[model samples]
Target: MTKVTDVVLNLIKIKGQKKEEAANTNERPPAKKQSPGELRLHKDIAELNLPKNTKVTFPNGKDDLMNIEVTLRPDEGYYVGGIFVFSFHVPHAYPHEPSKVRFITHPNIDLEGNVCLNILREDWKPVLNINTIIYGLNLLFIQPNHEDPLNHDAAVVLRDDPQKFQRDVQAAMLGGYVGQVYFPRCK
Candidate 1:
């Protein structure tokens, strides 16, 4: 409503005319620039419903909420005793635009295994929150969705046989080779 702010906003739009980012583009924004999703993430983490075996920590510190690492230990599955780490890269649009995920270690799971899940892919919806995503990830270890896997080879082995998949998982977790790829010990 003020003349000065209106002028500044016009200038920002002219410089960077992203329609989606228009609302947050203000004058004297803040000392620390956080995304709209940042506040949402803070609330989500505060009221987090993670299992005892799973924990999410900000490696960069609590100040940086955009990035977080989730450590999961499934007690009753192929990945039991295995420590799997995944980083959730929360975008400014976040719930609107999905956060990226990268697995730290595994055999049935791949390093670039973000696109494997339906939730991260075609089935993503704004209604889904961090907790939902975390649960989906936990489900992966209990039952790796081989049908829609990012690693085609791993998926194939997991689908074709259960015993071989278990052997491969054990080998990979112990810092051995599954196929040609070697995995570092995550135990």
Candidate 2:
């Protein structure tokens, strides 16, 4: 009985010593598991083939993939020659939830950069990806939708006088004042 007790005590001491050695080692803790959203986002980004005159960038560097910046320079349309920059924040629940997009002020976008795109709102689905959103944003510049707008005043002008809307867009792009609002030059 005494020999058996000594053997049990020695085994316990060995187990404790192993645990202490493991804790003292410089080995890093296990890497954090990537969420479903992150995995999907990574896949989408890897497969991106951006549209003409459009480019996607990572303002926070490649390490931070959640935050993205897209630059669009339309080759034709009322927004032609104008440089528009949009910031996109992909949620951890991305694809399940649309990425939050903020863009420069436009007829389809508010002064505070709130975009009015259906896919980014009610029409979003898990099947949609970053490429789709970029394409949609590019389309907005090609055809500024006055029917569904976040900037109502701009929309009204676009709906009522297409020519004046064009002029106003040009003026706004040149850092001129459009009514009471002043837009910085982006051309």
lDDT of 2: 0.92
Predicted structure 1: clash tally? 0
Q: What TM-score, to 2 decimals, does candidate 1 have? A: 0.79
What's the C-alpha lDDT at position 55 in model 1? 89
Model 2 off-target regions past 4 Å?
A: 1-30
RMSD of each: 8.7, 5.0
| lDDT per residue (tens digit) for residues 64-85 in model 1 | 8888999998987899999988
- How does candidate 2 fare on TM-score? 0.84
Residues 7-33, model 2: lDDT tens digits:
999999999999878867957775678
